[model samples]
Target: MVWEYEVRYQCLRERDKAYTNWLNRIPHKQYALAFDGGYRWGHMTTNLVECINSVLKGARNLSITALVKLHASQLASGNIQVSCFDRQNEVFKVREMPSGLEFAVDLRGLRCDCVEFQVDRIPYRHVFACCASQQLDWQVYVHDVYKMDQVRQVYRARFRSLGNPTTWPAYNGPWFVPNSYLTRVTKGRPKMTRLLNEMDTRMLRRPRHCRLCGVEGHSHNRCRQSAGANADRDAQ
Candidate 1:
């Protein structure tokens, strides 16, 4: 998809060099997915539903703590291997045992080539291995949003409840509602605002077909094989 974006960008640049030049003036990391380090989750041009769908498409249905625990367990298994580079930067190359696949880990930037570390805002197995190799603290890379202290801080605020509607201040703002007369008397559930993506498309059943003749255009009632069956039924 990033390659698709790149192809579109190149087309736009070729169509109008001036516009592309202006676009290049802005920081790529601020407006480009290719440079965002998987932080934006490709929501720049998406609607609310699309944005939420895009973000959760790759996320597991587990809680942050549960995912963290799972990753920690993988690290504790000692199946992953890490090799720190000699450069001044805190970059390490990690390889998973019995898999031979390697991932580049940048401790200084708090990111891994696998993107699990940066995207989740938590240290995954690769990050855990990198930290162990460097003797650094993996907790330092975790975002405060996933911490218990932040959750407790949210409840510290005093939210005094408004007693009842009768004692409340008189409302002066104009009220509006849908015109009931214009509403449709539909039979099924109302359609959602979301545009059906590939995932939704996969769940849909195929088009109707003629079971009697094994043809798609018409059903069994209209099929040529149905005539013989109808004649037999009439005699019966």
Candidate 2:
């Protein structure tokens, strides 16, 4: 597969100089599966990274100290919620809806028709209802990752207070230097927003052109030039 991609890339480079330059600008090792040690552990794209960035977008503007406090508070509150949920003895009933949709939950098997229990590893509305009906412990259905123990473990490490910079130990290592050639000058105000990719564009449909005649509306196999050539061969 890597060899095929390299061949196709070479063909593209031979055909288009601009495309070749654009391809060269990208790190092929990261994007190409043919490259050695390019495995991404089932993560083919940056969707996870983008999701995390979006989740922390608001926190990005906060001061480092404030952000740390916010995170600690959130973890503390989450642990409290988990503890409260664990102590709950809420009862549920399997009530039939007008729409004829009845949810059956099995706490023993940890399965629910709603599928939320399986996917989220947490008890869904139906599971809660079932647990209430059977008077079973619903907390057991919740995944361990969301338990109070796990939440506490996540925030177990305490942040140490940063002392005065003047009191810090002096570095005896080699002095650091910056390369003037690598430094970039700001021509204008930096863009704070992310640019949309081709997938995000409204104009998605591209006109197909005939590869043989270099014309629209037909492909190489159905081109007039190819038909004419076939006719000439038949005549010969």
Candidate 3:
């Protein structure tokens, strides 16, 4: 339907040279077909990257050793296992016993039909199954970036101990300066409470009432009797 709309738009706006040119230039493969070679797997957005950023936001202030230890502990906590495997054209068939789903693993291509291995760059259950069948070390298939050894190497460089602040070298640099333009000014006293929108007002509102007669359903400002009374008072 979207593609049809684009095609219809091109026909309807034939005089629109830029729009026509843009529509013509759009490739069929880009919109009509899936990504070739499974490079993207099934992920279509940066939600995964955003999720990782959110997860690590809390640990950003932590020391390097603490970060490494946190990651190591998380890695150790995962429960993945290898079930049976079969060999065909060097493709190993692995079954995730828990999910009861089978996946084909290509050791040469370093890809699994399930797609998790490619995305995570780690040996999933299917890859594990393949390793178990061949009696090969599964750790070899895992990317070095995730390995404990690589994580340990990050903390190997010790931070030099700092002596007393009194013994520190005297300041040789220019005085610190603040940018005046970037400084924030009071924006009419900050609002701690949220302003009610139309939906919120509708939900929170009490039963409507006529202030003129103290009756429900209408307000005093809109009351016909009040208007008539006001007119009579003005005449008097």
Candidate 4:
């Protein structure tokens, strides 16, 4: 019964007709139900394991030892807190965003919205999300996701330039390059010097002035007037 549940629940695709027929043959009398799960969801049983899956989703291809190391790294990574920008408040809050999934961090708890946070004490993606969000080095995070062995081969391939760069694999459709810095200069464009001269420098770099306190040295947050105002409120 456990084997059947593992197969039906965990396996990638359920297209095999023989596997489906075999599941039907398992008699209830032959097996003792050990686990107590309340009312199973019909068809696919994903909700039952979503939390676990989220924890393992990023490093699904890793070996058993690698998985254990990944878990340990996750636990340790949680303590390393960073600042998160609150756009609405226009201030930086001292909070930890998970690695890799920093873009999806919950403003309230500073936690990743992924399921790993619920099941395990820490989500592995937090490590990657935090690094990416803060623009910190993410090589270690990538290493964790695609194990060292896989990364080694990838690095070797890149070093050798083994595969054909142009006219290579088709991804079925055009893939959008995310977080790319490359910009293309089309033909018949204005000269670079002319374009730079046409720009309004004032709009590009705002004056170092604080609207809240009428200051020059610092922004509103760090201004002496703002600090004095807050202190006055606390005293009252």
TM-score per candidate, chains pooled: 0.34, 0.26, 0.26, 0.21
User: If candidate 2 were superposed on the true structure by all CA atoms, what would the RMSD be?
Assistant: 28.0
Model 2 residue 167 lDDT score? 93
* Model 1 root-mean-square deviation: 24.4
lDDT of 3 at 155: 97
Cα deviation of 100, candidate 4, in Å:
16
lDDT tens per residue, model 2, 1-236: 46677788989989988887988898877667556364662354345456655556668778999888877765544221101122244322233342345444555566655677788998866766565545667788888998889999988999898799999899899998999889998876776454333323343466678988899867889898999999999999
Cα lDDT tens digits for candidate 4, 37-81: 323331123444555666777677879999999998888666545
Off by over 4 Å in 1: 1-78, 160-236
Write the residue-wise lDDT of candidate 3 on 98-212 in tens digits.
4556666787677887788889998766676567667887877778889888999999999998989999999998998999999988766665333332324464789888977
**Between prediction 2 and prediction 4, which has the larger TM-score?**
2
Pick by lDDT: 2 or 3, better one: 3
List the candidate 4 regions with Cα displacement exceeding 4 Å.
Answer: 1-38, 41-45, 80-236
The lDDT values for all models are 0.77, 0.65, 0.67, 0.53
Between candidates 1 and 3, the one scoring higher on lDDT is 1
lDDT accuracy of residue 171 in candidate 1: 90
Each candidate: how many clashes?
A: 0, 1, 0, 10
Candidate 3, residue 203: Cα displacement in angstroms equals 40
RMSD of each: 24.4, 28.0, 24.8, 32.0
